[model samples]
Target: MPLRPSRDVFITCAVTGAGDTTSRSDKVPVTPHEIADAAVEAARAGAAIAHIHVRDPKTGRPSRDLELYREVVEKIRASGVDVVLNLTAGAGGDLVLGSPEAPLPPDPAGTDMAGAGERLAHVAALLPEICTLDCGTMNFGEGDYVMTNTPAMLKAMAARIRELGVRPEIEIFDTGHLVLAKWLKDQGLIADPVMVQLCMGIPWGAPDDLGSLLAMTANLPDDWTFSAFSIGRNQLPYAGLALAAGGNIRVGLEDNIWLKKGVLASNGDLVERAVAIAEAMGSRVMTPGEVREKLKLERRW
Candidate 1:
């Protein structure tokens, strides 16, 4: 397929992820209030969507608490932020093996496994306009850790998400995951205007090189709406690449922390940079309403 650049692009800021980056950068939001503020800030900076993940206020660790998510959602709603809320449903599938020799008993502390319903508890309660769906399981990083999302789990979750009338941003870490997404659509679980996030540069997943990115975009169905991002330094650079690939852009503190060599970035800063890059490339940054129409999202509130 030839390179067809995007003319109207939407930006999704993955505000704060469920990563161990709080200690590394003070900019990572921990409390519910902080996360909501980050989302609002990103919205003001021209992001069409805010992808959220809550954290333990005291420990700064990732959390799946319903109350915490409630506070964040309520705060953002109360703030009158017009950005589309995209809550994460990717938290409860972490698995860490015990050891190479003793891999039977997985480490309880590092492993967090839950059923489809339990995993998407917050989404069921809050009814965000969009939520993520990890299409397949893979080794997330260097360790016994694996991001486990079985076909059964994804099918159940996708069915429930469809019933809720929320669009699923299928998280594609590798090319195989894209195949699984197609299968889900074939199964009639994923509906029209399929949205996908081509997550790149993560260890044990697809590399951040241009060749890998082109290969991923080439396989995508023409009708599907997609976005791509690479972590670390490539995160900002991928803004141009994504535009050239005829997809949207994703950038925020969740993917990368640095604004420059020694600068730590907030969600808003990353989003501002993305807007500038998109505009520089002669693409218009879409608003929340435009994105909703583009994705055919059903906003809960």
Candidate 2:
């Protein structure tokens, strides 16, 4: 894909992800109040959207508690921040197997598989403007674990999301994932002007390189709206890269924990840095209202 150099771009700040990062950094928000506060702060720092995932307040472990999500959404809504809310429907599909010899019985502690409706309980309840649909399954990290989202599962989840009148942000971890997203669109499971998030540089997934980014973007449908992001050190660079590629940008603690080496970053700090990068490249950072208009989002709250 050519570098189109967008004049105006929107930023999505993934406030807190369903990851084990809380143990590594003190800034990771674990409680609902903390997550809501971080999301509002990111919006104030010029993020058009807040991609949120809640964790167990006491244990700091990723959770699928509907109450937790409800609290977070309620708090953010009450704060009156004009930010698009994109909730995660990517949890509850973690499949951790036992040793190769004992793979038949999955690891009880690490495995968390749920039905489509169960996984989307919170999204169905809160009716956020947007929710994510992880496009495909993959070996998530260095382990016997697999992030399992079968085709049937995805179809069901996408149908429910559409029925609820919420836009599904198709999250692609690799080229194949993008292909699957297109297939879903063709099947009419996904709506028009699809929104995609090209997630790069996670273990066992697409590398965060210019060539890889270009390949992913090049394959996207012309009418689709997209954003691209990479994790850790590559996060900041991808901000300018995505804007230059005529796409939007995403940044936050969910993807990276640092503002720089040896420094932990808050969600606001990441959004602030992304805003600077976009502006330096002569691109204007868009507001939530602008993004909602562009994406045709129906804000249920």
Candidate 3:
């Protein structure tokens, strides 16, 4: 007989991401209060985990302002909402390439690179149980730029994250990114049972297809833990797919803004949707404490 998850599976709700996507919808949280409240709502809807990225409230744009991140983390910890904290170390690496005619100088508005320590300063102090380490650079959508994470830069960042005792969830956008993640592990830059998030169907990167998902899934070593998600419409489908692959599910407004074709979705709506899907598959929706035990995670105290 085929085995199933006897215990509940954990659900992570990405409350907000660094994407400049607020203009597309008004539901995206902006201020610290809004972000914390959204996270609390997601947790209540069965999200054991809340992945976060803060923005400049005034501009609704991605911000690495440690104080903004600090306030957001502080409010969430004090809000009495039991949820795992997963910060984003990816706030400062948006690199928009320059025109081909003059490739020497990066477009002033496009490239914003920071030292690995500076990039991770928010995590160093907030010390969330988990933070994302983008595994490799790729062409994000049909944009003129490609996300960049050189091996040297990633190694340095990984070393610093290990020093801080913060677990890194490798976000792999393509199969090659998984290769780099494995290399980082082999080099001892990252710890054992490394976590990977297989991101799919974002324009120029890996497509949201069964074959692509299987290829990336097959690339993972037996000891590694992995998750998969498709942007927009595929988010829920990939949730089922990830579970079948013995992985977890991530959903929220960060990747998809609508519950249905025409409806706007709140963070809680997305979490509840994922929970329903997981439960329908004979998997329990894990609570924050359950996730703590599963991931060996420390509560954000």
Candidate 4:
């Protein structure tokens, strides 16, 4: 398929991920109030959607605390910002095994395995406009950590999200994941007009290469609406590449820390940079209402 340039594009700012990056840069928002403030700032800076993940306020580690998510969502709603909410349902799947010799037992400190229902607790409670559904399992990073999302787990989560009237952003890290996502859609588990996020350059997943990106996009169903992103320095470049590939864009501290070399970025700063890149490429940055209309998203709150 040929690369098609998108005239109008929407930006999704993954405000704060569940990564352990708080110590690396003080800009990574940890507290609920700080996360909410960062989301609002990104909205004010031209992001149509804010993909959020709350952390432990004291340790700055990723947390699945329902109360923390509640506080963050409430704050964002009360701030009067019109950003569409996209909460992360990708947590509670981290599994860090023990040493190769003793791999039977999982590492407690690194393992955070929970049931599908537990993972969707916050999403069910808050009912954001969109929540992610990690389409496949893979080795996440250097350690023995594996991001585990079984087929059954994904089906249950997708059904729950559909019941709550929220859209599922099918997150695909590789070509096989894209295949599985298509299978899920064909199985009638996922809703129509499937929304996908092509996550690139994450350690052992899909590499940030033009060929890989092209192959992934080529396999996507023509009717699907998708966005693509890469981490670190490739983030900005992929913003234009995704738009040129006829998809939306995503950026924030969750994916990259630097606005430029040696300069740590906030969520707003990343969104601002993404907006500049998209517009300079002749793609108009879409507003929250425009994104909602295009995605056919229903905001329960």
Q: What tens digits encode model 2's per-residue C-alpha lDDT throughout 130-197?
A: 99999999997878999999999999998999899899999999889998998899899999769999
Q: Can you list the residue pairs that collide in candidate 2?
A: none
TM-scores for candidates 1 onward, in order: 0.99, 0.98, 0.95, 0.98
Q: Residue by residue across 1-301, what tens digits does model 4's lDDT show?
A: 6769889999999988988778788999999999999999999999999999989998888998999999999999999889999999988998999998998699999899999889999998998999999999999777799999998888888888888889999999988898889888888889887899999999889998988999899898889999999998999999988998899999999988999999999998999999999889998999999888988998666
Q: Sum up the clashes in candidate 2.
A: 0
- The residue-level lDDT of candidate 3 at 120 comes to 99
TM-score of 1: 0.99
**All candidates' lDDT scores?**
0.94, 0.92, 0.84, 0.91
Candidate achieving higher TM-score, 3 or 4: 4
Q: Comparing 1 and 3 by TM-score, which wins?
A: 1
Clashing pairs in 1: none
Q: Residue 38 error for model 2, in Å?
A: 0.4
Supply the global lDDT for candidate 1: 0.94
Question: Candidate 3 residues 1-301, lDDT tens each?
Answer: 1333434578888887867668887898988889989999999999988999888899887788999989988998998879889898886677787767766577767677898999999999889999999988887756567688899889999999989888899998888888899899989989865778888888778998988887777777877777778888889888898887777899988899888999889999888889888988988887889777766777758
* lDDT ranking, best first: 1, 2, 4, 3
